[model samples]
Target chain A: MRKGFRTDLRWSDVTPKEKWLNRRQLMAGAGALVLAAPALAQGTAAPGRYSTDEPPTSLEDISGYNNFYEFGYDKEDPARLAQGLTVDPWSVVIDGLVDRPGTYALDDLLSGVTLEERIYRFRCVEAWSMVVPWVGFELAALLGRVGVQPGARYVAFETLLRPEEMPGQRGGTIEWPYREGLRLDEAMHPLTLLATGIYNEPLPKQNGAPIRLVVPWKYGFKSIKSIVRISLVADRPQTTWNMLQPNEYGFYSNVNPQVDHPRWSQASERRVGGGLLAPRIDTLMFNGYADEVASLYAGMDLTRDF
Target chain B: MDGAASLNGALRRVPVWAVCGLGLVPLAVLVWRGLSGGLGIDPVKTLEHQLGLTALQLLLAGLVVTPLRRWTGVNLIRYRRAIGLLAFLYAALHLLVWLWLDLQLRWSEIGADLVKRPYVIVGMLGFACLVPLAMTSNGWSVRRLGAAAWQRLHRLAYAAVLLAALHYLLLVKVWSAEPLLYALAAAGLVALRWLWRRGRSGTVRA
Candidate 1:
């Protein structure tokens, strides 16, 4: 590793995001304000270790805008069309090279680990980005709970496929049931999260509902939303974007500003909630999470892997 | 046929400049949207798409002038030049928004995109086709170049409109009906003359 992915900054040294708020009434206004609460409840937890002190993106922008192709192609389509999606009584199937392989209810699967708030920098492959305050436990905790098999080298994730509610699926926008994967080491990385909430509120239907993965270092698509199936496999699994266009997207979609997408420049990004005032800010190495996740791809050339 | 002729005669009194001025309505809506919360989540993107769509829609409307005169006998031919120029204005504004607001004039990256990305190339070529047409959209230029040569030069609008539609269609990461519909409409407009002639050649006199 050129420079170690280690920050000397302690969790306590960094201020809690709540302290950054100018007004106390803002606490009540936190998270997405769209309609009522979601059907499922993962319950709230205390702030986590890796929470960024940066002022988070507004809940309105975070929940209102989305890239959920299952809902539709437009950013607004998810909010407009995904309201009817049924996320209650959800379950996730843990299969492949796990010691215990079975369908577990959403609550049971996420039962043991303590959920905590982690405000992270989220960068989309389209070169737009947001800093979301996500609430969840690390994927490592879940993998530990499920018990990874000896030969498992990769972790594949699949999103919930419900066509009747998701009209974009009816249009054959994708192959249906979007899939994503990560190397075993990447999956087990402490920074890798399976989020249940945003801004300490239950995730909205448009913003990946019951459960979603958040890999802060990678492009937003790599953090597959509304995940249902998680497989610990011996081989690297196919991903939706990678399978669609391998030239553009890659399995190791770690945010490297050096590598540019065909459509979007990875060198910089338009901040989603920054409005008209803010100019496009320069993108950082590993989206500024380089200190945390850089070691994972130590010797590999990201330009080639990307 | 008499009703169509009367409607066409009445349309002539509305003034071509008034119709061209009415094209600013969409831009006004855009301004209102930017002021209010209606520009959606990413306002830059919403603004860019709106301007681009308005340009395409106006270009298609200009294309329909001939078909309307031929088939329906509603001659909008008087307002065609104004409509075409207004469409060019919107297209230029769309390019400006993309450069200034969206890309922020990152010339090096923009140059790379023009070279590497097919959609960007398509959009650039479409805009390039409009530049000459827009520059020469004057009576003096028409007189200098002569009507025949000017008309030949103006055919670039067809290529520009088709490319604009294709740019939109290609830009989408997933299959979307909206862009596809626009593409289909553009294709129909581009082939309108040939399609109309083939259907009428069997019976109808010019």
Candidate 2:
């Protein structure tokens, strides 16, 4: 879309996929680290295709801090409480306006497709950020396989709502089975990833195990976690935060520094592991995926929809 | 000689210095946590939030002293100034952390934030109310303004505490028990003050 945009860079130039896969097998054979063994067994993703130049926040910080309200409200609650979650037997139901719609097991769904690493800049609506290396395939790949109908204009998602499993549900703060939606165009964008892991390992339960959506252009909340259902719809679908507080959290929620949150400024963001005195840096529009996704919004008013 | 002797007596009765030491415990713990890496991934935010909460907690503690004296007959009036001053210290630390650590001394941005962020506006209003209170916490100011005027001016604490509590409530994106509990506590303190005034008025009528 613009001169010198990275679309020209081949995947092999960015990442030597074969060597990365071999390294994983080598590590698995040697059993170098106890913690890394199980993660490798699940199939380690090749080095990332699209990587943000920013330093990745530490594995400790990425895993430790989270806003999986299904686990709890506090930042650390998910890491502490999500251990009990059962994700190995997970399945996602696809229905509504699709040619093929059925409940598909996580492993069965991902069996044929290749998962590549995507290093993305994650900007939360709360004005904090991290650069995460997510392992997943493009949502478009899955949508293509499922065959989106001509009538479908929106894609809706739902998170697991088990009260016993997700302790935060007991608080009754938001309607359970957290829901989020995106325009069909947004869903099919190249940057839209259905992530299964981060940091070259299978996602920890706290970090949205099995599967989650990662729309790098939008606020982190729009990347719904621990997804249970995805439905293609004709009408605009309701989202969790939008339904909860329409004024504060909007449907678009594209990370725009100019559009400030009601409680705080979105112009700058604190890097997650950036210690006590770390200076907050300016936030980028569309979380720095403007080249790939900006045209999708074209003439639409993001401020009104945001 | 008599005034000097009464000052000494007041200090001994209330142990104001000891209360001040107790007030510093939160800051000490915060510093210790900072040095030891106990402050999780986002230490800056942890420091900012913990200091603000400490300030609010101390302010709430200061509000309780008047009621404690009235209902339980515990004359802690001497320690009130010490508690109020300590609360101001924490509030000042909170603001400094936000400005220096979070905003990195971007004066123009800070000015913009003050106008844009309602929580910051209310927090600043509470801090503004404290400036006069802290400036006049001494006996000289009481004597200068007359005790009636000084007490009336210090009554701004009730308003400051309310604003600070509101700042916390508005800052939190989610409705949780903790911030709500602080709001309830502040409200309860204000209600107690009103009830005490009503009881005094009834006694005057009698």
Candidate 3:
């Protein structure tokens, strides 16, 4: 009975051909609508709407699709098989160029420390990427507590080597006892975190359980997993990938799109789970953290140094 | 001897149409599952994994036909066409899932991915080799091409099998034991074929 909402209709609005094209257009429009509707609804939402300053990316996605060489060389193998590993009763042997040198249990190291969540864009050397909300204190903070000496120019991290735990170690696809290294300055960067947990949970076995390093500016592999030792050395330490293919993987291993990997292009990265139509996002210099960390390698040629 | 005779009678009685339909069952099931939303939430991953596994299964089945014929003297020649066609069906499914769900009709991206990813390149090469084998499976093509030429062209299936295995291996960021085992099995089949050829030629010369 209320005439207030009465709508005006024209004869042209109901044409059969137009209706058919409209249906086709509606079908075509559905894809864009699916992607856009949620974003729009959440834009000017209620007071209790959950939000975080962190980017819409997660460490779970990154860690879930890891290629941990120590566990296995397969991308999904670590996720499938690393669950067999025992992460508890783990201890890290910290020595060399530090004032205090002794073994520290993983729990003891993690118990009293304050953990903070920092959202980071992780770029893999293979040119895929994800946003990760990593929970850990700065590596510099931990190093400060350990008291590093002036002569320490590099920091080397080593993964555990028990063939019983890591079955891949039984066969020699790579030299056993995987190792990764970082320059002293790189290790001391504020963003570098010795991560022990992610997404408010203990690190998954596949994602370098017990402990791992997170150097955000570099390629993902530079962040070593299942670390058993951290040694401060006076010389540059030999990294596993660098040792394997010196030309392809350099010691620095910064995320530089211009410097392509030998087998693949590094100019762009596919955000996993992004539907087929989502164009690969162009990779940024230093993985979009260039402003914060590029000063560390101000003059060095990244292509050559890498 | 009685069982063998019955099997021969069964083979003779079973209509070719029925065998063809049976051969198509795997593809039909896949299509049904794909349309019914039974392939799980991530359709692409589900399809990719299923097609990949099926491709491996069909390849192994094709390999087994030869050894089985020799070992049991079962005359498995009748099954060879069906097995090869099934292999092509799985391979076609694999390519379709990749093109539709993974690449999504982005011709440029598809082209780029095929060129950029070594695994994709190898997979395309394997699929290319399968086209000829599938086309020439019919009796008409065999007769038109002549038996000698037909045999020569169909021999490309061996190369297709190897390429498919390589494609699987190269796809993963790191090597897994499962795929490696498949590669070893494929390699063993190829080795057996080579050994059989050598033995046959040696016997002929003697």
Candidate 4:
């Protein structure tokens, strides 16, 4: 799977052009196919029309810093502890309110769709933000193929629960097999992706390997990781974070500066990769995807629904 | 028996300056890491957490001094003031990092956090309890306030440590072991002090 590279454009605009051109040339000659955790922004994934022009956070920071509590809670814990997680032989059980009610292999689910490179703004409920270049196809492509039933109103996702592999699950931090769901409309939105990889490489275990949901406009938690089961249900599913603290984390956890979490203000976010001293940027409504996603919540009060 | 006695005597000889200098090592390392880009991806959070954790650790160390003297006869009470001040130093730096670097002087956001965030309010109260203790951490202040009054004022440390632990517990979304352990330590030490007071009064009653 050759990820499209526009190195001559994105990084060239950010840093010196010659640097990226040279790096690309070297990577091309050196066999970039080995999947050795390729360096940051290497073979720059094409920025979607919605993706911000801001340079993607370094692949190291993106991969190393994560909140996949199935691995652990600390930002660094997932990277350190996500080892031994088995992603191969992976099949997703698509059941409940869907025509297709059987376990489908990861390859079978994604057999026909063309993978895209979507550089997206990822804002966590913790008020830390990052730009990621994800390699995947729209989730709606798979949902349409599965055939959502007439009664299906929400799309629920579940992460794998293997205590032997995921150490955090052994602890009582959260109920295992973390669950998240989105309204049917949000699930089928063009921007929603079921990411397979990042920075043009296969998904790292820490960053949700095999398959994961990516709702770019929403807080990062709404994008459940390392999914094993996806259900098209009639009612909204109880998401892990929201179930823990409903007032703090909403079901439709869209990134809104006005609705602050009880732990931290959402008005501004600290962008990673700036070391220690970079100033925080003002958070945008729907994480700057309001134009595309705002109408999904047309009449609903976000503050209340949030 | 001689070896244990000598080890205890050596520990007693450890000076206040050395204790403070050792306590400041984490701060120095933090600043150096911040400058050298070694503080990992989210350096501001790394800085804030390390500073806060170190402060809690130092407070725990200071609290353990009395138990050590009572149980083991280590008699290292002279270092208590330095340890308390060092904890206050890290707490101050932690708050500074949150205000200056993490928030970048977003006063409205800070105000919102104070009002809406339970953890933020608890942490502020913890730090607030430390303020008068920090100011009065001297021989002159003790003489001015009278020993009994000064001792009563310094009982704020008990409240401060509990608040700091609660603040940490609340900050984390889960009741994980790290914050829970800190909260337990804080509660255990305070309970130890209370038990000793009861023991002393029981002797008087007898």
Candidate 5:
């Protein structure tokens, strides 16, 4: 949660000082004692291994299932359908207001950055969640390379559009080839990530393949997958969802429990397969990344702007 | 007396009820799994997969009945009703799982999904078409409708099968070879039926 703390060891290093007690193990051991004690004497339920200091239910579960329309629309469609995507020759074209505007190979983009294992809650706009351990450098670090001009107000992302490689493009389901955008400040948030992998493994093709953006605070779609282009522009870029249904999916698709999606309430999300025992947790404003990204939208009325 | 003896012989050779009972194994297994909580941690996904696969299997089985009957010269016509019914049963289960488990019985949301999602719409269409076919499968309805009308009504199953395949294909974002394979098989079956019908009509005209 610190702003600029750099630990010398690589994320994979199993250093004794770096390794902490597993929270799940601790909870399993102490849960019975806490349950037996008098109700008044008992403290709040001990946070589990993946628990963070962020406000309860505010932090989006980061590892939730994703429906990257590129792969397929089904929740598991990405995993099975994405396998056919060719990711080896992936390149991202950076254009618009930036000084350095050229296509960069995915390997070049990942070369110098240090990967950090950040565990964050990821809440989908569809109302589901999961805690994911993402392996990537901060989005701020990546954006720093492509110096933003003073007038630059927004960042636009474009996903791959080849029909041959992506059969979903052949259909007219969602206007084909997906696109997403974010405000420059939101794009540069420290918590935002240009993630290349998950669970320490190279991202499966269905999960955006070579590289995908992970904006924990925003709706999952805003974190575009199979990104092939990024444009720095003065005006807000037209996003896919906003284009499809502006009334439903606003340009600023931030996770706000108050602003219900036109069809369904965004107030709560099921933790996919969390079963009958685990209650659907209430969704948090800003997906529980408020302390980190709330100030960016502080004065703006999120309900109207949302 | 000869016609009566032939009719009696055909009825005696094939025990339609026993064959229909045998087809109930899959449904029994599905129910057992649901009750025992063997649907796994993600019951929705499990149910969806099972129902989808069962629908595919039943469709395949129904397609095979005609070919097998023609090749073996056996009274496979009797089993057609049972196969058609089983396909309807699995399709209904597929619809129910989506309704109860996926949509949580929220009719408004279900309506919205049907309207917005093309796959859901196609699936509903397929299921709706199967309803009339299943309803008229009985001997009484067949007798009332007559053979010509009955065959015309039952031809809707071909459309239902195609719609079901399309529904499966569109539902997934990525095209898995499995769904594509099923689609291809369904296409072949429908094509074969058309060809056979055309051949029979040509011979009759000649």
Candidate 6:
């Protein structure tokens, strides 16, 4: 597996004259492939079109700063404590409202899928944002494989909750076995990705190792990590954050500049890696994925759902 | 000379400059860590939070000065100016971090935060109270306003200290012992001042 295989194609496939003329331009764009992590060399993946022109955040920042409260409450806790977690031999139980209801090994479940790079803007309910380059397949493809039943109107996710591994669960900050769900339509949205890795490497334990959901249009918390159970249900499942503070965290939890958090304004968000003195940009409707996801909630009151 | 020696010998020997320098150690360490990439993933947020915490701690220290003088006769009068100024400096830096770094002078967002966020409002109120106190901290302002009026004006420290403590309490998501510790310190200092004043009035009557 040659690293930057796509980049090699740019030069070898081009005419000598053309390559010479576009050398500088090609070198600058070479950055996209050059910084890719080792697993990205698998060459079965394609770059996503919706990716931002903005530079990808450093992996240290992306993996180091996280909000998996199952590990601990502090942002740095996940990186520090999650190292003890064992991820191999992982499997997920896909039950409820699915015709193919059974436990499946993660590798066997994703065996036929092609991983793709998706650069997305992740907005936290706490008013901080990050641009992440995640590698995964669409949730729709996985659901298709599972064979959803007609009664299923939602997709519920559950996180691993071993107190010995996830020490934070010993404390009552949030309920054990953190759960989240998306509307059936939302679960099937092409934009919704079930990420298995990031920066081309297999997902680190801190970043929800092996598997996680990445719902770009929703708040970061809505995208549950280290998922162990994925249930297709007829009703919306109780989410961890929403259950903890119903007024502050909603089930939909879409990124909206208009609706403010109870304690803070959501009009703008601090970009995590944007450095000191970096101007906070105004948050976008649906975190700038409005065109793709807005119609899903066309007539519904976003404020109420939010 | 003999009578003056008996008044407050310990206070005369107070290491005011040494204490102020010691107070600055945390800020220096934070800057050093920030420059060397030791402040974890988000250095700016870390810096902002640390500065705010330092400022709140300094405000608590400043509040304890008068009570210490009355109760223990270890007057920190000479170092009070430095302590107050240092608190103000850190508070000012905290505000600058939020304004210039966090919000990037996004006035509308700031206005919204002030209106919607009670913690921000309380924090700003605490900062506002410190402004007049910081302005009148020096000898010239003390002389110009007359010592009696100056002392009366600076009593706003009590309100500022309480507001700052409340601001910190409200800012935290969970009810940790850390914020409560600061709040208790502020409350104790305020209570000590009240007890000292009542005792002094009893002495006057006697």
Task: Place model 2 in a CAPRI quality band.
Answer: medium
Q: List residue ranges in candidate 1 displaced over 4 A.
A: A1-44, B193-206
lDDT comparing candidate 1 with the true structure: 0.83
DockQ for all models: 0.60, 0.68, 0.10, 0.74, 0.13, 0.56
Pairs with steric clashes in candidate 1: none
| lDDT scores of the candidates, listed in order | 0.83, 0.84, 0.73, 0.84, 0.71, 0.82
Where's the lowest-lDDT run of ten residues in candidate 2 chain B?
A: B197-206
Evaluation by lDDT, superior candidate among 3 and 6:
6
- Model number with the top DockQ: 4
Write down the TM-score for model 5. Answer: 0.60
iRMS, all models: 1.8, 1.2, 4.6, 1.4, 6.3, 1.7
Of 5 and 6, the candidate ranking higher by TM-score: 6
lDDT minimum window of 10 residues, candidate 1 chain A = A34-43
The A-chain TM-scores of all the candidates are 0.86, 0.86, 0.80, 0.86, 0.79, 0.87
Q: What DockQ would you assign to candidate 4?
A: 0.74
**For candidate 4, lDDT tens digit of each residue in A115-144?**
766889999988899989788888899899
Per-residue CA lDDT of model 2 for B49-88, tens digit only, reads 9999999998998998767655555556778899899999
Candidate 5 displacement at residue B100 in angstroms: 2.2
List model 2 lDDT by residue over A1-306, tens digit each: 011112353333332434554554565477547635444344455445566756677778899999999988888999999999998788899999999999988876786777777889999999899989788889999899899999999999999988898899887679888999999999998889999877656788898887999999899999999999999999999999998989999999999998888778888888888788665888998888888788988898888878
Candidate 6 deviation (Cα RMSD): 5.9
lDDT computed for candidate 2: 0.84
Clashing pairs in 6: none
CA lDDT of A299 in candidate 3?
91
Per residue, candidate 3 scores C-alpha lDDT tens digits across B93-121 of 88987777655565765776778878788
